[model samples]
Target: MIELKSAGELDAMRLAGKVVATALRAVAAGAAVGTSLRELDEIAAGVLADAGARSSFLHYQPGGAPSPFPAVLCTSVNDAVVHGIPNGYRLRDGDLLSIDFGAEVDGWHGDAATSFVVGTADQRDLDLIAVTERALAAGIDAARPGNRLGDIGHAIGGIGRAAGYGLLADHGGHGIGRAMHEPPSVPNEGVAGKGLRLRPGMVLAIEPMLVAGGGDSYRPAEDGWTLCTFDGSRAAHAEHTVAVTSDGPRVLTTE
Candidate 1:
């Protein structure tokens, strides 16, 4: 069922969203050459602890996952697309890192993801990250009331197609509220005017996953959590949790 947030519930979501945003910022800021992925996970866990927030990703096991996620952060490095497990791997110069994080506060859930480079980034990697962020912004822009859910995906997918990037449309965004994932599967590629109609209080997480290579295929790594690209090409992912309002769209997660 698609649940709408009341004013008080929206306030609760914002509080949870702020915790996620702050933790993401902390994790991103700690992404440096020679920094271990485990270290980044620690940074996120520390932030959540201080804010009285609990990690939604930790111990979360979906159907496809081999086991419950053990860490607070999903640290995808380079060709590792999404759901990357944080481990003892150390960051290197020119490595592109994508951190997907979610947190819960007072029983409300907030989620977001960001992609960045560790040190001196390659121009190709820089362009990919920029494009992913723009796609996220475009999706958020189309979240106004009266718009269809497909419009959000259409706007995001168009950018990737125009740039000749491979999109992971199969694993797109989803509705998020009291739980980490919910109804209304928001695809990254769809007809602009199709899918569920947007309305006030309907909150959705819009994320765009783009790969530099032609293939969109990925596989689960041996770690039982990370998803890696089939051809070993780098990928970028960016996301924001937004709510449709009577007047327009209200973005709840922002730094």
Candidate 2:
């Protein structure tokens, strides 16, 4: 069932979102060419500790995952699309990195992800990231009352298609509240005006994962996590936790 958030619950979710935003900022700041992915995860852990928030990723064993997730953040680099486990792999110049983080505060949960280059950036990588972020923005903008859930997906997928990028077909966003994953899966591509009708107090984590190879196929890494593009093409992911309000879409996961 889709459990809509009350006004007070939404306020609590905003607090969780702030913590998630702060951690992402800190992780991004500490991400340098020489830094290891594990080090970046530690930076996010510190942020959650200081904020008195709990990580929504650590030890999380969602269905289909091989084991409990072992880190506080998901660090996908280059071809790796999502669920990239933090490891000893060090960042290098021109490397594209995508970081996903989530936090829980006062029983509310918020999740978000961002992608960027480590040091010097390639034009192709920059373009991929730009398009992915644009797709995320479009998805958020469509998250308003009187609009259907598929409208948001159509908005997101349209941008990727027009840019000649391929969106991951299987993975997308979901409802977020007391749990990180809730009802009403939100796809990255859909027919506009189809699916669930948007309603006030509905909160969703709208994420867009785009691949530069113009294909949607992916493979799991040896670690039982870290999905990588099947065509060896780099990918970008962007996300925000947005709430549908009487006024419009209010993004909770922002700085």
For TM-score, the strongest prediction is 2
Worst 10 residues of 2 by lDDT: 164-173
1-255, model 1: which lDDT tens digit per residue? 899889789888999889999999999889989999999999999999999999999999888777899998999999999998898999999999999999899999999999999999899999999999999999999998888988998999899888989887478999999998999898888898998998889999999999988578887788877788888999999988898888677778875
List, residue by residue over 1-255, the lDDT tens digit for candidate 2: 999888899999999999999999999999999999999999999999999999999999988889999999999999999999999999999999999999999889999999999999999999999999999999999999989989999999999999999988699999999999998899999999999999999999999999999999999999998899999999999999999999999999987
**Backbone collisions counted per model:** 0, 0
- Model 2 stretches with alpha carbons more than 4 Å out: none
Q: Alpha-carbon error at 141 in model 1, in Å?
A: 0.9
RMSD of each: 0.9, 0.6
